[model samples]
Target chain A: MKRMSMTMVIVLLLIPMALFARGVSEDVTTLTIAGRDGAYGDAMELAIQSYTAKNPNVRFELLKLSGSELMEQSVIELRGGTGAFDVILIDDPFLTQLQEAGWLADLDALYRKKGVAIDPDLVENMVNIGRYPYPNGPLYALPHVGNVALFAYRQDVSRKYGIEKFDTWSQVLDVAKKIKANEPGMAPILFRGVQGNPIVTGFLPIYWAFGADILKDGKPAFDTPEALNALEYFLELAKYAPQGVTAYQATQVSDALLSGVGAIAIEVWPGWIGNLENPELSNVVGKVKIAAHPGEVKRSSSMIGAWMVAIPKDSKNIDAAFDFLLHLTSAETQAMISEKNGVPPTRHSVHKISSLVAMYPWYPAQLDGQISGSIRPRTNYWAEIESVFGDYLQRALVGNLTAKAALEQIQRRVTEIIER
Target chain B: MRNRERAVYSSFFYIVFAPALLIILLLTTYPMVTILYDSFFRYSFVVNTRTFVGLGNYIHIVGEELFQRSLINTLVFTLVASFSEVVLGVALAFLLKRQFLGKRVASLIVIFPMIISTMVICAVWQIFYHYEIGLFNHVLTTLGMQRVGWLTDQRVALASIILVDLWQWTPFAFLIIQAGMGSIPSEIFEAAQIDGARSGQIAVKVTLPILRNQILLVLMLRTLDTFRLFDKVYALTGGGPANATQTLSFFIYREGFKFFNFGRASAASVITLVGVAFLALFYVRRLLGEEE
Candidate 1:
């Protein structure tokens, strides 16, 4: 009787194993993507739907998350070598740290294995952002989102102040003063003043324009004269900003610009002003002009904030993820996503699409910025550096510290961080 | 025979207690030991590297200005918010101790804030505290007063967060205290009344002493919860307006996750654990001494 019972248990287990083996032999592959939320999530869903329609044997699982949540989850999962995610989207500034840890699979190797070449239609500068050691190293990812920081102003407001163009930071300040004096209840200058990433991103273009750099030959440069000048200039211009501007974030700045209450925003993202031309959603349709940031001691340059997509080293479906990446970045897909979801495209061909250009009049300027924009200091310690820089910069903004004092304090803290 | 009976009892006790003991060790003791070990090294989670630093991390963080500021803010937030909530909770419990009209509805209304999600509460309060168009600012403007930066000004930001926390958590304290008040035998109050005691005397002499254990328990829970304040500050301030609302938990989060400096984060965690353990011991000792 005991022998019969053991045989029954074995038969039951064998039945399921045989069934599982049969299931595994089927021609279906499910690729998991750790993507971003909001418009990016919508765009991913559209691409998944299109891909599934063409290739019925493949399916997808998309984990749509916020930027921070995505970073935290991907780090934890990738660190464990779980093979839970096939594809992951990374912020450009953070890609280096992940690459340094060898978390991402090599796209160059995958391309060579498949006997194919990289698509040249994607903006070369954006594509270079995914390369470790920056611009001359092996490619590990592809650009998924083309984000460039741009300057925006109310053309009518500037013309009313008798200024045709902002050629420098000083010119911006003069225009801001005139707007504040003449236009009651209108904020003349706006930027994200909340501390950390928002404040640092908003301040970098100005910092760079003043011939100051975060790192000069791999050391802190905040103690330089140019950094102090840029900070003092920033504080003076901030006088014409809205009350409670220290609390302003992307939402507040974008709201002020869209409602016509802001005359000039020192920094704006393409994603934030996608609906600026829509009459129903925007109060200043056809009245706003977005362009490259103005210069100071040096020439103007925009900041590149592209999101990169890569396959994790532990992903079980690297080939599938790589194929999907190609589909996701193709010019046709980029144009479709731009029209339907308002995600800026990373391809030259997509930028020249007449329909897209008409909808987004800043496409030419965005392309120019993409070609010549500056990437944030690429380092494994970028997060720590940005955090320290932001904290002291806001201390100056709120009058807790003078510009020179803030720069000196930043120099001390950042030098310690790098040394540690 | 007595020895045999004791052995049987021991066997049953072991059988019943083993699973819970194993679970407790796995869940609590293991992580505590890991954090303690990691605190002694300069650890990087990303690079998977660790260098022995002895007490360097602890000394460095203790001397850091940001850590000092975060500690002060956390202590101020805890003392003010928890005491205010407990006081308000006791007051509301006494005022409603007697039978009143619409008692069920009143109790429900009093507990509404605690029942709602914290993120939802934060969203509502964020709108109410907006600088330009918020309800509070609009009312102030209507009364011919200048608009206040409720969240933008460093002086007012921490106070505003404390107010929100008190609003959301006072009901929790009220529920526990009211339950304690309910469990007291009515004859004690009657005896006090027959002894010529007034309402105030009875409340102080009879009711409060009887409810001491419950109050201490609630206070301990609130202290521990408020000490680990993270979500509200994260959703509302992001520790901003120049680090006005940075708490120890926020500091540790930024160090561990944002900067990936596990050694400093683990050190901060160990320090927080010791502080919380000390507070728990004080409350537990008081409760035990009262019981004896």
Candidate 2:
């Protein structure tokens, strides 16, 4: 019994010392990153490899999570103050919510401590998206994925029909009808029609093109005539989509485009069509053209959907994570990642690289979209709004609700969400 | 001397049972109590804000159209999927119970769907259910029939999901029912045959009566399992084509995880728990009554 007591005392004494050692090492050693999957994951892996090669002392624990998974985990961990993730990726819409909750480390303070300035090479507009108050608030994140909604169509098919320019929604619709008439085998229109994020994202560019806004002066704007027009036009355009359009996601849309079975997609992201020119991966090599969406009542409305990287406020290795963040967003690193992984870079110099432009052929249009594209409404309630809107929009598409009725329902629901 | 023995026995019982009893309380009772408490508040988990709303959340959620629709859809899914799966399972159990060629292989094939991953099943079914180029559509077109939207049309999407559920879970029911059937004596059937009872009549009067407890057991298990349907709906339809396939679990997921409305999610969860508790009580009472 005396020996056991002695042993227990020693174990109890060592526990605090071990905890002290961990506390000391936690701020300087391993950096845990809660990142994204797919191409973004690849890009982050490349950056981690390069960073680790330079600083052999720093280790990484990377979690490549789905978009929703990332958001949910980040919230749970950050809320609990677990310090589980040193760095996290935030979808732009959710960034506002995270920032509002003060869950992100102040990047500006980190920069001041490091005695460095924010790089001008990074797109200013994309950088501003990481701001809490949006475009003016202190920086909390850096743009990691320069995603913008882009329109894609078969150039060959358009030339064959003598439709040289897509200047308006009407022109696109006319072309879709002609293509459907001429080529029964080809689907004239394609977009992500599944409910929630996919459907909302696919419809936003068209919604903006028709001069409709999701929010105006902190109020819901779905009841406007322009919004009704946009929905009516979208429903009409959706008629030319595939029979299973309502089930179409990014994979189906991209597959349809790449296999040459789809003539036009009203909304396509830069990441989805990375292999559009790859002969081995695409059947429509050199046949498809990617550009900004066609204008309707307004100029082409490219929806910016950049993913941002930030150091969590509860992160232990904040300094190391900030350094890695800088390296990940650097021009050379962005260029290398873009080349290898087909991830769109947020840096202006990387976007302007001639080789990348040659391979992508839409870099200029993508850069233009990044510079001027309208972002989703900057509100903490965007997710709820998007969910409600997507649900109603799909109800309209499936003929359960008329366009006007859907908009009215969205208006009512969005008001409720915002008020609450 | 008797009192001393009883004291020792009682002390031993407490010593053995304390840890397990404490663990059970920590695991189940704590979270349930927390959920019940939170359901009466307005809580934003992310911002760490809580306001006592005093049944406002419950009232609001119960009145929402989406919640009503989700409740109805979940009930339909549970009832249809559970009953159909039980029926199909019994039919299959009867078919396979008789001595036949390749019995082992047939049994293996019968249980294949239950063993495979739900996501993989959903993926294969998704391709088959694809509206344009799906195998089902291709077959329909080849036979000069109009292509049906198996997953897109609201009217058909729920039915299609139910069909997939039946395909996956009927095997489980089959295994349980078959085991019960296997326990029945060969002499019972022989006596029935000798008494000039027809095959159909024997199955209905004697066999089914004997399998009543087993059938009820299978039905209860299936009902409970089907009531929590999530992953298939998440992978295949994402509670979509206009929320036609949304279950109570999916509703809570969207409210809790997606929207971070913890209070509302708690209310929905409490509602579901109450429902499941009622169902479990009904089944347990029946089973226990049978035993009695």
Candidate 3:
């Protein structure tokens, strides 16, 4: 009798364990995505909801992290081949490193398996960034956030200064000087002068416009005269910036522009100015003009800062992730996200959508920038390179180092990083 | 029987302590060994490449200007912030040792900053240090004084961060000193009073001597904590306005996590660990001497 009762209890425990196991293994396919937080997070959440609503068997576990945190976690996981994340969001510049390392899945093979091709609606330049080699390589990722660095100016202030157009960096500097002299209370120029990515990113458009290549023929090119001129002009423009411009981030720049306290912003990402047109939030709603960066020695060179989505090579559910990625980047979904979350769309059709264009008046400018945007050099050492470059650049900006000295230091350090 | 009992006791002790020892070895010693190993190689985490280049990473990092600057900045921050915190803490503890009304409330207020999250504290201070719209600049302007670039000026940026550290961590030192003071016999104060010792004399000659160990303990703790300054620098200045606030921890983070140059980062970490261990040894030796 005792043995029978013990066996009964064991059987009862086993029943629930079996049921629980079955519950987990049942047709539920949970796709885990490591994505960015903030607006991108919101957009991902929307896409996940829509995706799950259509496919009842599919669930999602989304890890929304900051840019740095995402990079750190993804690198650790991908390098270990842990397959912890099925999909990841990578900043465009970091995409090169990941692709070169063979950490990302071959999307070309997946597309071939699915009997589909990359949609033509996605901007070629934006999509090309997902490739490893410059413009033609095996696709490893897709552009999710069509981010391009653009310049912003107070149109009213520009007109008041009798500036019909800002065609050159020198012209912009002249206008800034005029604005600074006339409007003592207002900051005539603004940029993210904070060290590292912020300062480097803010300086790139100007750097490229001055015909300076960050990497010329696969080597550090900061020692060139073009880079020196760019830095000199940037310092001149800095004279008209706020006293604490070196501490400024995206928030400060956007706040300065929206408060109508700044005449021009040297760099403005689409993500930062999503609320620029919101009348309640902006004092300069109708006054600001967003456009591609003006030229100096070269034609306009807007820096591409798109965020890309990729399936990790070790992903357990490649087909599911690829399906979700396609859905997420589709024109319909992009339009929805663009309309609701103000996430800049990767698709040209979404950018041209009447509603989105009306909402984001700079949609045309954004599309143009995306088509013509220049991506940072596809080098594995970009993170280190950008850091060294930004450090010296900021030192020069704060009068710690002269422009020539800063470029020389940057060139030396970058050369060291490359050689290592 | 005693031997048998001792054997059983030893077995019990081993049973209880072995797992913990193993965990500690795995957690601390394993990482240290790995870092030491990695420091000798040219490893790039992003590229998944590791090439053995004995001492090359160390030599390269030591030669780098930024690494040297970061080391100096970290040492300066550690000394200034830690010393300021401990001294201010002792002063506050001395002030609070007396029986006074609202002592509990005052103590709570004193420890408030210490209890708040570091990121939150940094956020609050970021606003306070803003040049145009900050509370400090507002007060300065109201007083018809020139506005200071609390964070934007390289000369003042690190000091500005140190001030924030003082604000947040002085309370911790105060708490330690206060606890030490509380443990001291009230009769000692009474006896000192009877011997005609004034308040300042008693504090300087008696109380301070008695509180030397606690002060040293606080100093060691604060020194170690301030030596790894990353968050405030990250949130406030991003080690900027010309890398004035770039601490060793920030440097390691940039190299290891941001750039994925594991070899260089490991070398930097080993160097930092050695510095911290030396500092700890000096304090521990002094503490042990005091105990003896």
Number of the top DockQ candidate:
3
iRMS per model, in Å, is 0.8, 0.9, 0.8
Deviation in angstroms for B193 in model 3?
1.7
RMSD in angstroms, all models?
3.1, 3.9, 2.5
Once fitted onto the true fold, the runs of candidate 3 whose alpha carbons sit more than 4 angstroms away are A1-24, B1-16
Query: What value of lDDT does candidate 2 attain over all alpha carbons?
Result: 0.93
What are the per-residue Cα lDDT tens digits for candidate 2 across B1-292?
9999999999999999999999999999999999999999899998889999999999999999999988999999999999999999999998998888899999999999999999999999999998877999999999999999899888999999999999999999899989998999989999999999998998999888999899999999989888888998899999989999888999999999999999999999999999988888899899989999
- The better candidate by TM-score, 1 or 2, is 1
**Which ten-residue region of model 3 chain A has the weakest summed lDDT?**
A126-135
In terms of DockQ, which candidate is stronger, 2 or 3? 3
Tens-digit lDDT track for model 3 on A1-420?
A: 999999999999999999999997787888999999999999999999888889878889999999999999999999999899998999988888888888999999999999999999999988888887757998999999999899999989899878767889898998998887898799999999898899999999999999888987898899998999989989988998999989999999999999999889999999889888899999988889998899989999888899999999999999999999999999888988988899999888998889788889889989999998898889888888988998999999989899999999998888988987
Q: For every candidate, how close is chain A to the native chain A in TM-score?
A: 0.94, 0.94, 0.96
Candidate 1 chain A weakest lDDT stretch, 10 residues: A21-30
Error of 1 at A8 (Å): 16
Model 1 ranges off by over 4 Å: A1-25, B1-11
B1-292 per-residue lDDT for model 3 (tens digits): 9999999999999999999999999999999999999999999887778999999998888888888899999999999999999999999998998879999999999999998999999999999999889999999999999999999999999999999999999999999999999999999999999999999999999999999999999999999998888999988888888988898999999989999989989999999999999999999999999889
Model 3, C-alpha of A320: deviation from truth (Å) = 0.7
> Which scores better on lDDT, 1 or 3?
1
- Quote the true-contact fraction of every model: 0.70, 0.86, 1.00
TM-score for each model: 0.96, 0.95, 0.96
**What lDDT score belongs to each candidate, Candidate 1 first?**
0.92, 0.93, 0.92
